[model samples]
Target: MQIKHAGCYRVAVVMVLGMLACHTNTRPPVPGWPEHFGFGKTATARQIDSLNISIAPDGKGLPAGSGNAVAGKAIYLAKCAACHGETGAEPTPNRLVATLHDTARTKTIGNYWPYATTVFDYIRRAMPFNAPGSLTDEEVYSLTAFLLYRNEIISDTLQLNAVNLPLIEMPARKYYVNDDRHGGNEVK
Candidate 1:
C-alpha cells in the first residue's frame, strides 16, 4: 500500500510539471521586429499631415483656398458627374440628392450628413471614387459648394470658405445628437 501511494504522488508531480512547461513554451516572442520583417517605419510630420487631412465641424484644418458653386459645376461635370450623375440626384452606388426634400431618404450630403464642412473634408480625403485624395484644396471647396447649392442648402453664388463653410447648417442636424449612453448597461 505504501509503494502504491508513492507511485501515485510521483505521477501527480510529473503531470503538474508537464502542464507548467506547456504554458511557458506557448508565450509570444518579444515585441520589436526588424524592418525587413514587415515592420513599418515611423511616420514623419509631413507624411502624417498628408494622410490626416480631417476637418472639424468648426471648419478647422481647412486649407487656404476658396470656391463657389459656379466653378464647382464645371469640376463636378468633368470629374464627379460620371459616378454621381448630372445633378448628384443620381448617385450610382447610393442616392445622394433627391432634387428636392424627399420624405423617403437615404444617406446623402443634404439630408443625412450633419455638417456642411464635412462635405469639404470628405471630398479632400476621399472623393472622385476612382482617385481619392487627389483633388486640391480649392477643388474640394468648389465641390462642397456645388453639393450644398445643388441640395438647396446654399445659393449658387455663395463662395464656400473656412469661415462660411461652418456657418451653413445642414438639414440633417436635427436628427443627429451627442451619444448619451453611459458605460453601464443602460443603452440610452
Candidate 2:
C-alpha cells in the first residue's frame, strides 16, 4: 500500500507486527516429552488424610478423638511446656494462658480467640514451634482442653470432642462481627 508520509508508513508496519506478536500459539505438545519426572512417588490416601487436617468453627473437620484437661496437661508438659511454660504463663508473644477476669493482661487464646475450634485448628496446623504439623489429632484436642481449662473456660473434667468442642462458645465471639457483604456487582 502507498503511504502519503514516511511516518505513517512506519506506523502501519509497526501495527501489523504488533498484531502478529499478539497472536496465540495453538501448537500441540512436542512428541516424547516427559509427562512425569518420576522423582517422588504418588501420595497415598493415608498420607493425604494426615495432611488434610482442618477444623471449622462448627467442628466439621474434627477428627475422631476425645480429650480432657487432665490428659491434656501431660501432653502439654511434654510438647508445649518448653515454650509456653507449664501453665502457659510464659512472657513470650505466644502466651496461651490468660483469663477474661484478669483486667491487665495480653491478648491470649482464651480472651482473644473468637472460636473454640480455632484452638484445635491452630494447634493441629502449627504448634510445638520446633516441629509444625507434627502433633496428632488426639494430642491437639488435649492441648486445646488444657488451655481452655487454664483460662477458666472449661472445667478439668469436661471432655472435648468433635461434638462438644464446637458447642463451647468463646468469650470473645460476641465482640466479632461477621462480614455479610455479597460479591459480584454488589456495593461493598
Candidate 3:
C-alpha cells in the first residue's frame, strides 16, 4: 500500500520494533547458574551486623560507652592531630572545629552540622584519616566529646553518652530544615 504520511509511518514502525526488541530475550540464562546468576554469596547475619554500624541523629545505634573531653583530647592528639591539627583549627580542608563567629570561613562541624550525634556517627564510621574504623567505642566517644568541646558546644567535663549526645542541641540546628518531602517530581 502507498504511504500518505511516510514520517509518521516510519516512527510507528520504529516504536513497534523497539517494543518487540525489548520483549524478546536475546540471551538465555547460563545452564548451571542460579536465579541470581551465581554472582555473589548470600551475606551472613554476622557480616550484616558488622556493616550495620550507622548511627542515627537520635543516637539510635550508638554503642555502649561513655567519654568526656578530657579523655577525648588524648585520643584526638594521638589519632586526629596529624590531619585535623592539635586544636582542629589548622588550615586543613575539612576542619572539625570552627570559631563560630567567623562566617567567612568554610562550614565546620560546630557551625554546619545540625546534630551532635552526627559527630559521633561520622567519627565512628570514618575518621583518623589513616585508619577509618580502628578506634574503639570508648575512643570514638572520647573523640566525639573532644570535638564537641573544642567547638564550644560542650564543656570539657561534660560526659557524652548515647542518651545525652542526642539531647545536646547544636548551634546550627535552627538554621537547617528537615527534608520531609516524599517521592515526587519536585527537584528540591
Candidate 4:
C-alpha cells in the first residue's frame, strides 16, 4: 500500500513538472507572417478592396456622392462636435479648422494643409477620432465642406464630393513646395 501511494505521488509530480516545462517552452506565434498570419490563404481582390479604402490626391480611391456645407454642419453637430467643437473653430483635443484672424498663431487646416484633397483624404481615413471610418462618403464630403466653409475657404452652399473635392483650392496650397532632396549626404 505504501509503495502504491509513493508511485501515485511520483506520477502526479511528473505530470505537473511536464506541464510546467511544456508551458515554459511554448510561446505565442508572431503575427503578420503568412502561414502563422491569417485563418487560411491570401485574400481575394474583393476582400482586399473591402479593406483598402485609402484615397489619393489624383482621385484614386474616392467614392461617389456629394455633401454641402449646410448639410455638413448638421453631421458635424451630430458626430464631430464632441471632439472638433461646435463651429470647428473651438480647439478640442484635436485641431480642426484654423482661425483666419490668427493664421500666424494657430496651425489649422486652412493655415497648414497644402492641398484640398489632403483634407478629404485625411477626414476619410481618420476623423471622429473615437470611431474612424464610421462616416459615409457623403458625410465625409459634408464634413469637409463644413470645415472648409468655417475656415472661409469655401462658400456655405458649395457642394463637395470626389470629383469636385480635388478641384477645391486651399489657401495654404501656394505655401507648399516640393522637397528637393538632392542626395542622402545633405538636404538642399
The better candidate by lDDT, 1 or 4, is 1
TM-score: model 1 vs. ground truth: 0.68
- For residues 84-159, what per-residue lDDT tens digits would candidate 3 score against the true structure? 8888977688678885586538788888889988888888888867889898988988988988888898999987
Residue-wise C-alpha lDDT for candidate 4, range 24-141, written one tens digit per residue: 8555556865545457787775686578776667665667778989999999999888877787677554667775456445578877776777777787788778898788888988
Candidate 2 runs further than 4 Å off: 1-51, 178-188
* Sequence-dependent TM-score of model 3: 0.69
Q: List model 1 lDDT by residue over 3-63, tens digit each.
A: 3543465478769998899777654656795434666798875686557666789765666
Candidate 2 lDDT tens digits, 157-183: 988887799999888888888897978
Best by TM-score: 3
TM-score of each predicted structure versus truth:
0.68, 0.67, 0.69, 0.68
lDDT of 3: 0.81
Q: Which portions of model 1 miss their true places by more than 4 Å?
A: 1-51, 180-188
Q: How good is model 2 by TM-score?
A: 0.67
